[model samples]
Target: NVMNVIISKKSGQPTTMKLNGVVSTSYSDSAFKFNKDFAISTDTTTFTLEVTWRMIDAEDGSAYDSTDTNSFKIVRSTRVNQPSEGYLDCWERDLFLQFNGKPINAINETMNKLEVVFTTNSDRYKKVSVDITHKSGSTKDSLLALPLSENDSGFSGFFEREVGAPKRDNVLQHSDPDSIILIYRNPDNPLDTIRKAYPFAISKILKFPAASYFDKNADGKVDSIFIEVEGPVDQEDLEKLKSSITLPEPRKFKVNSISVVKGGIALDVTEQSNEIRTYVSPTDKIIVNSGSLPAGGLIEGNIINVQDKVAPVLLSGTFFSDRQDSLQVEFSEPVKHFSSKEPILFSHGGKTYRVELAENGVFSKERFYTSKVISVESGSAITEGDLIWINPAAGIGDTLGIKQLNPENRRVPLKVQEAEYEITVRTVNNPMKPDKPVPPEVVNVFGEKGKKVPPNGVVIVVEPKGEIKNKIKMDEGKVSIYDVVKHLVKKDIEGVFDEGTQKLYFIWDGTNEKKRVVGTGTYNAVIRATTISQKTNNRKTFSQIVPLGVKRK
Candidate 1:
């Protein structure tokens, strides 16, 4: 981010000032400063300071810049009786600079005030330190202060008390430069050495690993989390991690709202094999679909290992009516074998289904790409919309051969044939007016008990006004569509069906060969519904007709 500062006085030329802080390197910001001659006249009390800034693209210099300006008043500073260079000053709050011999008034307090600066590289996993010798000053202890961590302060606060202390103390803990780095404070007249002796390391980064576990209840969410590190953790670093690592709400798509899980269980820490481990159970779970849960919140802090991620996947599942009691499930990885012993093997609709090996059941011992297709015969007849999930306790394995913390649930939408079939043109244009020649308007059709409707289940033919000279041949259950006219689309008619709403909507935009709209006319539209018997895969079709009228106006 780049910022330009301008100091302007009434009816006078504005002066552009340069700040001393870091700029453009992406994550760090430095203070703005101008030469001693650039300080506004001590006599001018009312002037304006306008700051304009834009973030430049790091890859190329192009910027997603802003045209707005942030302005602040150089509020009048009450004069205080003091030595020439001994005045106190502040820039709003977080920054404090004491000019050795400048008086405590507004104007002469320009860029001459020495600003403390800290610099770091990148936005993740790095060494960090503080630099206070912006230009040497009278406070010896203040000059000695160096940033311990991105978040630690030492003795530097004594020099800038008039400017509020930094609000963030973890700027150096990670790669982000936005964290506030605090400094130690000391008195000038009555010097205290106790705070001066505060010791801290300015450059050290401890790499760590983090991982998330799946929710046990198959509620489609994540509730358990863990982090691992080598050896014992520094007390200070541990505190920083606890304060910085937050669990964001789970989301399938990107969104920018998050809040801490209230009444959340505190993290639990354990030590093993010269490694430190921290775990936490959330008070509430984060819901998700069948894929990897985001680990962004963990990666930003450089606490997560890119290699330790687990993604849940569904392999395959199919229904077989040859044996009404059998269903087969295959996983991408080998699973712990369960025979007829485990009682609560499969769960669905709040009930446990027992499993028995079918005559063709096979349990392969292979790892990934395993051929262990599980064939289980249950007593209950599997009906439509039957979704069954395996209990992880029953032992499903991930690709690593490790028992899955939460395995992907299986979905089963059964296809069945209903005795009676119904079809109707639910909607179509009546005296339709074409926008842009012939705008496509939906010609919706409904199929009753259409759960088994085959693809291209509906075929439609538009017969122009007075085209039917004689009645067409019709059978008890079929309509003999003569070759006199062909359906607009020679392919199957595709549609979507909402089982809950029992609605099927079809689209017919009227444009055809050469993309020409059918000439304005009154016409008859015949629609047919086709389906296959799920048990025998045989064709079943039904037909209906409706009137359509169009106008080019």
Candidate 2:
């Protein structure tokens, strides 16, 4: 027999190795080491081999076949070749190369079909790079057969270069509440440039992009696409924004019912024409305002979210200023109390200035517009944010208020103070100033109606323009010397039952709160007696009038 080493065991004898197939066996650690160098080979048979090892911590666990870190690679015969040999464009022509399936271009290891291979390294990356030598000797410049797509079994779609970046959304969501022009950008464009900006004028022309892709081409029927969606928090850069962003508190916006006028938002509601009745929803209530309600109707508040932006201003310097006169407070949001700033500005020129909100003119007793000549002279008052143009001679600091436009609609932020109303007194009779003893009327939350009372005693609740200084009376061709006044003198003056009209009617020859009646006398007079729901505006409005005409007295 050829020379060989055999390790044998005998009964009650120590283990020994026989060398050269003869006696005098000297055991060798070298022979055992050489044995380990070669892989074990067995008779060709359909069988399985398992490798088991104890982990550093976990015990008694049998290792799996895949637990072996050692691996092998099987590359395709025509994976790469110089142009001189032959160009293989099969990978580029077939989409199957991108997929992990049969006839794969590359393999990491040898395995039987349908074999379950466990791996100790849970995290493993298999990457392959193809290098086709284009130039070889005299033959130069060769084309490579590159994969058109790549598929990961874990993900639904394959990663393909030709498909390019994801198609960005073409449909635009309205972002600005006030803007007439909608501005936005294409979602897929790396530059973030606007694909389409719709102006309010061309709403009909713009159509939403077709979303046929959203429909399922898979299964030849409708099916939900297996999409890998991620929340904002799950994004990588989102953590950076967390520290920088300051989220505002959510607030409940109370919607007030709009008061409608006659003739479909008519400029004048007097002619007794077609009426426009206001309808209030369960979540809404009417708030009667002197100004007109919007013609288009109420807009939703949800669309206008919390806005926070900063605009530069001129505190004391003349930087980008029109004059040392006016300014505009560009706020992130439209201010609640606009046109009431203690200091107003010029929208054209950036300038900071102090303003006189009171009638005293920095020293007058009256406040706001009342101090201006409009309250006393022509009666034209100046509201806050009115451009105050200073005449050089008036004084170096004298700021004369002038009319001007709000720049970019960026008006002054209104200064919010304690809520209160201002009433103006117009006309009263010459003689009975002290005799007019009346309590201020308490208007309900609806700005109308009074309470029901017990019998015997009578009370009158009147809403005058201002405090009645003297008995109210109108002027000649004004609401002055009239039968109503004559009737008042007969009953109130003599304290006798003058006429039936005097008992129920609040007759006035047109007069204002000041008791100074005018030819154009417009006054708000309230009288209380016994009124039913029929007479009132369904528990809304209270009294009626017989035209308080003040004939020339």
Candidate 3:
């Protein structure tokens, strides 16, 4: 029998030794060592072995064909070292590799089948390399030296090359034609370490690159495309690269509704326009077109949502009755109360009026005329033809924090003339009369009208010229002016009045609203009566004013 063994460095050729064997009884032992002292060399980290065994019948000399050979490799490990042997703890370093800014996984493939990417995590390694191994037992592993020719330009943003560092090699080894393999190598290190094997497959791959934009806010779609390549590139090169990146084409956008509006404006969008080829950003709202539409003209197509970039517009605003106490203003949308913060000036004729929130204050959520409403009590009386400028300094904005624009359109033109009021007052001598029959157990929540009659005080009765219950004068579906009975002079206003008895009675002392008594002169006991439904809009408005005389005792 003959036993032969060959040992060699993992990457180098092997040396063989042949030994003669004899048959033994129960136990047989043979010890043999290599004549050449095996030393841990500077370049050899591992070794491979080949063993061959053959048995021939010595009597026949015609050998029975029973020869077999086996090959195997051994890796040097530090923890496995013996106390008598000097060993170095040489562990392979970690090299993190990514493709197109993403960690490589078995499922995800690269754009180019020919490209294998490697990224160095630490500066410890003097050199980095990759090896491509095919299932067919062929490897195309090579060292990579970076700063390729294209990196001379400004395209370094893709891949930033470390200055004053060793060059990186192109690790995509394509020499082996049978199959492809992925092997990364750190060849120069003398440490007893093996290359980190990255299990990758490069076959039956798609040819084109995929692109995706990244949204910083994460509100919706991607916001940007960050290309990571090893090079410097110029603007032209970048443009070419950007144009070449294949992303799903953006959907064609169409206008939903476009119209000439006197108040608020919008480019209502149902979808994004085709012009945006990258992504449909939720923040994208409006796109200005060159075409023009006449006033009141309407155009319809697709719609795109947008932030309200326009200024606060007064769609319709009205003063309640003749009293300048309160005014209701409707805006195109909910607006910031800039008028409260800044000076809201109202200009009428030659006089200027600084408008502000009334003692009653303003509301954050209120609406009128199917839009946002601003019910304000004036610090001063707002009369007819008063031009109201809401924060002429431009502080008002929408809910999205977009500020209002166009100073000229912010003012409220008090176009409608102040309503004319007519009131009649009469003093009756009879103070007491037969008590009117009352319904028992029916308490009057609102005090009885004309009760506790004032003998010398005037009895002011208001009678509407028309069926004046709630008069809603509207212009283009918007309330131009809402007029109703406010209250009687020097008396609390009552909401309920027997509509059947179209007459409203109010009793008051012969004094003004300030409760100051007048002198003995022939003073007109002006019975200030207000229009109805203006209480929620509380303003000193009178539908009629009556005058009566009181003689001194």
Candidate 4:
């Protein structure tokens, strides 16, 4: 706030002047009566100031300087007659949205609440509007939606509060739907010290959906989000964001070598004597290299390349021997065997550690935990509080992955903790005593018992759920076809049946156009018999020949 010290004069006019907090002498014609309500007291006012967010290189939402010329003014009155830097300016309120522990940028950012805070510099406080913009772009396009795991400050947005109306303290949550690594900071927690130092290593990661993003240049398109201090940012004069939001740094391991020894992947092994050395391939495969002479080496398996890690096995004091040298090294504990990244089990306490080879062929652990691979030893040296990790070379075996080892100290387990089962599947199957047909009882009479008409006439009646639909043939001479089967597909059968008694009548207006067939040769009238289903597909047939005698007048 640049105060233009106004003094009492005959005329009432306000003046403007530049302020560097170093004004030596000043005089004005108008007396400036300050609004003591929100103004600084001349005697005991503190020079405390705050901004909603840090300013970006090319943005206008934060503080501005006189260098821009087109800057706004901060309105505040003076109550105390004090020194150079005792001024307060605050006016408009802002809506802050964050995820994990960072502020949201752009519009439509996953907002839990419209956080309100502001600089008193703007004259348009009473009337202010904001846009919550969330947009996602790729590297080729201008990445706006930052990934969750990328650990950094300044340019990454995080969640620090729950997504809803504002409150002093609630369960902090991700304002946007993007995945976030939550690292809580409670000033009064017993584990507060451990939470801040290695925060990324302590907290968990979760992915959600949110529409929050920012367009750094304000081109009407939200391009990215500024990930603020999700946690205590390193006290640096300047801090930067991670290289890429999508790809986070891979974990690391420290061991003498990575190889597929006698045991399978990521397993651990120890030398029996000082007569053998182990050779590990870049692919994480282990092999017994040339050594003096040795047999009977204790081998422990390792399974690495995991999304989550626990600890490795426990090798109850095993020794390594290259055969050439007699000095045998040793380790107190063994590594672990795990099923997958889910952490099924651990050899000892940390025996269930997972391993992930360098995805880009880079990444390593501290040298203190790294073994130099000296003479054959009974065990490797691993210290407490040490974050050990392993890295595999590129283009090695098993598609470029790292070999991890653990302590199998607790006597190879049965792989299962607790078991429970049910008889849902009918554990006992006794030949499935053949299924009985439906309708316990059915009457069976070969032919109809009502009437016996000449088999020469075609029968037409509503279809019944029986095997008598079509297999009834006219029995002309040898070949015969039923009216239903003949008209259904394209087939011609000669001879004629008595359109008798009108039981089955032919509704026709004129005589046959394709000529008549009142013949003497044997005409086949084949009908089909079907199952109770009434489907033509469920039918079979029988044939009978009938001799035609023209009304022997």
Best by TM-score: 1
Arrange candidates by lDDT, highest first: which order?
A: 3, 1, 4, 2
Using lDDT as the measure, which candidate wins? 3
So what's the TM-score on candidate 1? 0.30
By summed lDDT, which 10 consecutive residues of candidate 1 come out lowest? 190-199
lDDT of 1 at 553: 53
lDDT of 3 by residue, 318-435 (tens): 6554344345666556664443423345676656655444433354444332112233345444555577654546465555554544444445566433344333333342121223
Which lDDT tens digits does candidate 4 get at residues 1-553?
A: 1322111111122233223222223322211232234454544444322111122333553432222112233434565344485543333322333433444442222233333222133333233222122111111111122222212221223323232332344333222332222222113321221100101111211111111122222212212322222222221211111211221112111122222212121212122232211122233221222111111111112222222122122122211112211111121112221122211121224443332211222112210111122221123222222232221111111111213332221232221111111111010111111122111111011012222232122221212232222222222212232232233211333222222211111111111234343322222233322221111112223233222211111
TM-score of 3: 0.25
TM-score of 2: 0.18
Go through the candidates in order and give the clash count of each: 23, 46, 45, 127
Off by over 4 Å in 1: 1-212, 216-224, 229-303, 306-316, 323-326, 330-355, 359-379, 391-393, 399-401, 404-553
Worst 10 residues of 2 by lDDT: 1-10
lDDT of each: 0.34, 0.22, 0.35, 0.23
- Minimal lDDT window, size 10, model 3: 474-483
